[model samples]
Target chain A: MVRSYIPAEFIVEVDHEKCRRCKRCLLNCSFGALEFKDRVTPLHEQCVACHRCLTFCPEGAISVEANPLGFKYSHNWSPQLRKNIWKQAETGGVLLTGMGNELPYPIIWDCLVLDACQVTNPSIDPLREPMELKTFLGSKPDFLEFDTGADGTLRLKTKMPPQIAIETPIIFAPMSYGALSFNAHKAMAIAAAEFGTVLETGEGGLHRDLYPYKDHIIVQCASGRFGVHAEYLNAGVGVEIKIGQGAKPGIGGHLPGEKIGEEISKTRMIPRGTDALSPAPHHDIYSIEDLRQLIYAIKEAIDYKPVSVKIAAVHNVAAIASGIVRAGADILYLDGFRGGTGASPTIIRDHVGIPIELALAAVDDRLRQEGIRNQASIIAAGSIRSSADVAKAIALGADAVAIGTGALIAMGCRVCQKCYTGNCAWGIATQRPELTRRLDPEVAAQRLVNLLHAWSSELKEILGSLGVNAIESLRGSRERLRGIGLDALTLDIMGIKPAGR
Target chain B: MKNGRAKINASGIYYRELNRMIREAIAAGEQEIELIGVNGQRYIADGIKQKVMIIIDGVPGNDLSAFMDGPTVIVNANAQDGVGNTMNDGKVIIHGDAGDVIGYGMRGGKVFIKGNVGYRVGIHMKSYKDQVPVIIVGGKAVDFFGEYMAGGILILLGLTCPNNQSIVGNYLGTGMHGGQIFVRGKVEKHQLGAEVGIQEIGPQDHKLIEPLLREYCEDFNLDYNESMSRPFIKLVPVSHRPYGRLYAY
Candidate 1:
């Protein structure tokens, strides 16, 4: 150690008077922030403030807070920036972090507000009247043709492509099994099965146990093609070609060998303790035509299973989405900058990619303008916090929205941003058996189900208030939305009117 | 050889129906199946977990035997891109040259290409337990051969090429963290990737290549001794975890 200059970000404290000496806090602290030295002692430097010790402490005798050793206040040279500089100076390496970006970027969802029915139009009550939240994700024909039979009965003339039906428009975003614990993956799978929605098997291959919930799963084929076998392609209802991720765009993924344990090795179909690297670009896909080839190849492999192309919400997202739809993608998944990740360079996570709201609006507008809106359904994902965000996403031309961090939070993830260390206290992002066992799959599944149920009800309430009986009525209905604090240019890009107008 | 084999004419037939026919034929207890006129048909024997053998008369399109666990596919003509992609266990014997990105992320299988191959072949090829993937090319290979390879073996034999022409292209084995590559001819340092280290083949390496070359020679109907006459050089990863130290916790 060459004299580390980095200061402790958090300080931990133990209440001696209230401490029962049970020592559960010491066991619960996965980051090694607590130890028994005659009494419960705190290693403030090691503390990540995950609140695991505080939550598990029987007597509620532990507390954690941001370190009060304040630096000279300057907006340009903030404490975090100085700290990051110090860490880099000592390590001479790129700073890595977990979870979503912590930067205070503008959250577009907050500036946009939904319109409710006034006295002129009567609002429907969801309790009395049916509000349809059933969402189908896939390509749809622009028009339907009916043929008259000899018996004078009408039959369908056009052939229908494959579509995936979900009970609600909310889906669980792609979270790899290797990045997250097996129990966490299981919880999502169970919840998706129970909730009648879908969860994506990220770049990590699907485990044998998750085969039972294959119907509700969307297997992803990334640049690495880790666990993507023919059976894995056909295992899920849909196959998602992961072009780019929101957290770290224009980069590849490397699941460190330390995380590649026995089960993950088997699941990923690679040797244990070997780094699994996903190249930045698919080796075969160098152009739009190459992308088309891959999409068609997967379609040929799975036979009619809907294919989704997922890309980060970047500056040319609308045009990229147009090409993807033209390349025969049944669904388009746009992940925005605030999206969560297992591990990424802190700079990339905080700086790369655009907001999902703008990307969704632009893509939807472009597709509709090109008369190809029905060619592929859109799924907007990033920081979808609540049902209001979901409703807003639908109104802005998204057929559905996916939640990654929200789902983890439901399973007791405090977003401590230490998943890169593989010592997650919540048993969500770690592979350590002891830490992972802390999360009970059944309980976590129920909690996730409850969250989805609550959000679905709230979405129904929003639909009833909007005087729309079906959620489909809100799809691309920009008139139902208004910008409160957004500028004129932003409003024009989003295709929404100002608050007063 | 045609006896006890089920034949399907794939002319003007879509890839889906051709593959479906192959699957149906296999399901109906047809051990040996022959596909004629396989012009640009893709995903043959894809994800098929069987022990049957399929013979292709014409050129097959991309992703032949992709994710195939056990079946053996014999292509009489040149094979297009993505041959044996992410395949777990199987054998793809191409009588002619194959296209790019063949044996990508291939876990276990033997792919013998009689002629040359395109760029990025055997990229990200990995292995686990008893599953060690091997790609043997009798002719030259294009750029980025075995890029990002985690495990497995890639053998390049430029037997038919002129001495003036380079056997392998530039950026060879770039970003390779695992696995080994053996070239039967001389390769300049400029052709090698920064992550790759070249050395003379050892006895163990020779032992491994000998059997694989013998099999390749048998498949293409060439003399095994003639294929092994040239002195070989081996390329291995400089580091098992190439980007391990690039980040700070």
Candidate 2:
């Protein structure tokens, strides 16, 4: 048997005078960090800085601070590296984590600056101008056909692909109900519906109550095919085939049988206590041709509704996207390595998959070069942080952008990265009824609406400064962006010139 | 037949036009449809949940009856790949042999194949609550039968094996964690995946198969009692959580 040892990473500083010995922290702490040997003792070793105790404490007498364990830190073997090694050596288990990649990789969205017109081109005032931002996402025909008769009458005969029109370019990414609380999903669904956009019902099955908002919902059919039925397939404006996730590429996920409670059981259409596993690779979809079969199958199911194929942003993402478009996908969603997750193996979340910026640029370039860019719309996901990021994504040729972690932040996620424990004190990611109830769906939905409204306004501000009245004018206009700290390969890949050049 | 098919000659018609005709017919409250000269027309009866019937006189293309609900599809001739793919609450009957990955991820309903099936049949087939999917092939099945099958029933009958064919090919039920697979006659030890173990049919097993066998025989004009008289081998998962040992604490 292996012995256990872990250095403390947080110090709980408490005001004994204010502390009423209530021990609220002890009960609320899901990490088993707080204890009461005598009068509410603080076990700093187990504290993960989730701040559940501090928030729940009535007297507000407790606060946590980082324990500066400044070991002889080598850049190669940093404190994180050493601690991870120690934990693995002792536990003999694969490290599990929640949320997105925390590795301090380059955020290319920040490096590229948005361009504005000053002298030559006149700026349009968003308050006065129309500033059309209505965007329709789906496939488009290569060319339009026209019929001219001898009677001097001309008519256009073309059938456009099915698309969902959103007033704004921001779409809420797929966050499962099991991974996130029902309240969180409700908030997302409500806000998206109110905003005329879609909130993707992650691979989790659609709940019965959420049926009213099906028009604003995008159902996902992953490897597990959980809760998939005729009504579920037809309920959404579009259906997404989740081929892969960005955070943990080539890795399947298992929502433990314990999490399949009464409501989730009904939602996922699984037995009350049964493990739901999304296999790493769909057994039937061994090749691109197989992928085509599945795509056409879904298209046949929903006759006219558009179908999206979601895949991770791996090194071969461009080639994969090309195949998916050829396979008759209406939309292609690329999730970068920094994409959020309910839970994933720590190794794959950090080490696998590529960043979204390079992936988007490469895919756009490849599709354009192949002359099939019009065949499918591209939605870039992963770490879309701010309005600037959205503008830059559009300039990089994305039809739209999907945000998951950002929406969670709007719903009060602290980014403490303990979502896998399902004790999220902020009430965003957890299955426990009491913890989940802490989040108010109505208020959360309002907050999300506010966030999207502010972001939309900010996007208009950027467009106005660029002297453009339509959001479509900004798509694929890489000349409007300039790289600040990006290297030659990245600049070349992103199709952007250096800041000074 | 309570819902007789409204016959439509589909010779030289594009698949999209044929599907359009079907949709229009269904919208007009036609309960049944029959497609003649159906050469490689895909996505027939794809997702109509109403209680309807469709009959195909010729070869149907891939993904026939995909995501279909409450419809009975009968293929008089050979059927291609991905028949009954992800179907929910329906029946797909194929008279001739079918291609790969039949009933992939099917959640409900039944698929009855009167002849042989290609590789990877019943892959990822699952069931939820009272919805149990069942697939029966009259002839032999190739490799990877019931792979990753979380729930549902897959029965392989080797009555039509021309050669002294193996009951099922290699890697059978490779990642299967739930559900039961019954094979007629024999299955070699090497053919079984590590996660699966074979057992002699118990009284309970016999009880489960009896109803299914009776229904299958009646559907395809075979004798149920005679089919059950033959010996059967059942394969069950070694553990509910097949990958339990893979992950660490």
Candidate 3:
């Protein structure tokens, strides 16, 4: 075999004195980095630094660290650039990556700061008062008409559109059952059910086991239409039409045939070991009118369930969102450039879409300008790290925020960025039976539940400090935000005042 | 009134109300139902998971029988776009010409069109276990026929088209991966998509299509012998995974 130019990214060190000869780390290493004949040997080249072995080690014997002698250091030609160039020179293929963009792009969420009530306006204590975090996702009427009966009871004259209520304005983003394990999916489902939020069944259909939790599930229909039968459409509380993912905009998803096991095959409604390719564009939907047809067709199928449209935050996101709303989508899901994915081209994931903060600000401003802000609720996603980020999104006019990587972190993902390799050591992103069994659904569910509960509490605290009792009051209240280090143009576009102003 | 079949005049009724009325009639134990006027009404038998038969007189609109399961819909007139879209366990019979995107993502259904079909017909039709979708057209078909088809059978019998004219259009079965497309007439090599390969109909292929052709003849009142007189050619995907080698890993 020709000598490979690429060097190993990590170095595995085993302290022989501390080793107890149990070889627990050897068994737990999913990346095939450990081998034992007479003694446990480290194949540092295969190590992904997932920390699974480190965490599972019975004794303090193993330590994996970044290779200090990675490359000849050059400020202009960084190690990453040199590595990528060398990789392409060897493989002549697109560099595939898992998870969100790891680029050092400016995070607007960090640049913007929230406001707190001072002496003039007294802040309320969440402990003593009831703060409403509950929000509904769906289109709302511009005005409500009530009829006063002779008995003095007021009757609602206007018909209300279908809405799915969440206890908190935080939801689990779309993560396919096939991409993750059954245990991971179950954990998210149980957590969403316990938390009274929703989890999306990413284009790869809902599993039969998740049917009982259908009330908190939002079934997605992408270009591929995998496992989307009439029953699947009506199984969830809402249906989402996935147009584009933020990680890889303007491209299709290809779940390789290797990942198509018997169960995934059945769930996706394809033959075993066949590539499930979702075309970039829904062939039938060539225009906005065609999109409207599909939206209405789904509405007809599900009868009264709300339909959401998920789109990557492209340059013209505001216009696209407007069209989506006009095309009868009840909920609009906006995924920013920093969105997570099971697998995507590294180039596209880093360079394709805009930030969620900018997209949310633009779409909300446009919808409000057009007087159709009430036509559909907006859910912003892509690297919403904390409850503070969720509050900031709501203040920027998002009705809710979706968390994907954060949720996976709650379930023990170490952000190894090797999900596509099907060797997720934490068992959160892999489908291998042995690795998947590592994640206990009940335990992972409890962790997710705790994370959401903590975030909810923090949201309430943020709301109380803002002198608002309900999350709705904070929605679209841009005056409550101040741009810290953002330039004048950026602040103007986001419609936020400077920190001192 | 005829043979205990419930009849409804869908004139000037909205699509939603008409569908609701159809459901109500079915719930009321109407075994076979018929509608008199269905002009431009969309979603005729959409998502109706019943084994009952629906007969319509006037032309139905787009997305007819979409996501419909276990219901047989017979249209007396031409059907619009999106027929049998993502359908499962049902049958749709369109008497006249049908529009684009017919049988899209359809699984476990049979759609028989008596006349011609528009572009992108039978796109992404998949099969899972016992559910294999089938779409047969008696007349000519336009471009992108069976594009991205994953599974099931598609037969095009262009018996009504002129001898000089092409039976199928360009870029046939463009991204097809796991299905069979049968054409009754000759097609040029350039007309075929790069992902598909043309093969002479084998004995097994003949055996499989014979029963389907007989059923199509029965539905459209055509001569089975005459439909089979012309030599047939089968188009299958070159590889089950056309884009497998395109990626690095």
Give me the runs in candidate 2 sitting further than 4 Å from their true place: A1-3, A144-157, B1-4, B161-165
TM-score winner between 1 and 3, please give it. Answer: 3
Per-residue lDDT, model 1, residue A471, is 94
Per-residue lDDT for B114-147 in model 3, tens only?
Answer: 9999999999999898998999999999999999
Per-residue lDDT over A1-501 for candidate 2, one digit per residue giving the tens place of the 0 to 100 score: 644566888998888889999888887877778778778888788788988889888999999999977789588988888878888877677788888999998777878898899999999999998897889989999999988878979888787878889989999999898998999999999999998899999988888999999889999998888878778988889999999998888988887776779999888877766677888887668899989878877876787689999999998889999999999999999999999998888989999999999999999999999999999999999989999999999999999999999999999887888887677887788888878888999999999999999999999999999999999999999999999988898899888999987
DockQ of predicted candidate 2: 0.57
Model 3 segments beyond 4 Å from truth?
A: B1-4
Q: Rank the candidates by DockQ, best first.
A: 3, 1, 2
Query: Relative to the unseen true structure, what is the Cα RMSD of model 1?
Result: 1.9
For candidate 2, lDDT tens digit of each residue in B1-249? 324447889999987789888887887778889889899988888877878889899999988888888889999988998888878888988888999989988989999998989998998888878899999998888899999888899999877663356867899999888889999878889998888999999999888988988888998899877676568889988876765434433
- Residues A149-233, model 1: lDDT tens digits: 9999999999988899999999999989999999999999999999999999999989999998988999999999888888889
Model 1's alpha-carbon lDDT is: 0.92
> How much is the lDDT of residue A276 in candidate 3?
92
Best by DockQ: 3
For all candidates, state DockQ relative to the true structure.
0.69, 0.57, 0.72
Q: Against the true structure, what is every candidate's RMSD?
A: 1.9, 2.5, 1.4
Candidate 3 residue-wise lDDT, A251-340, digit = tens: 999888888998899899999888898889998798888899889889988986899999999999999999999998999999999999
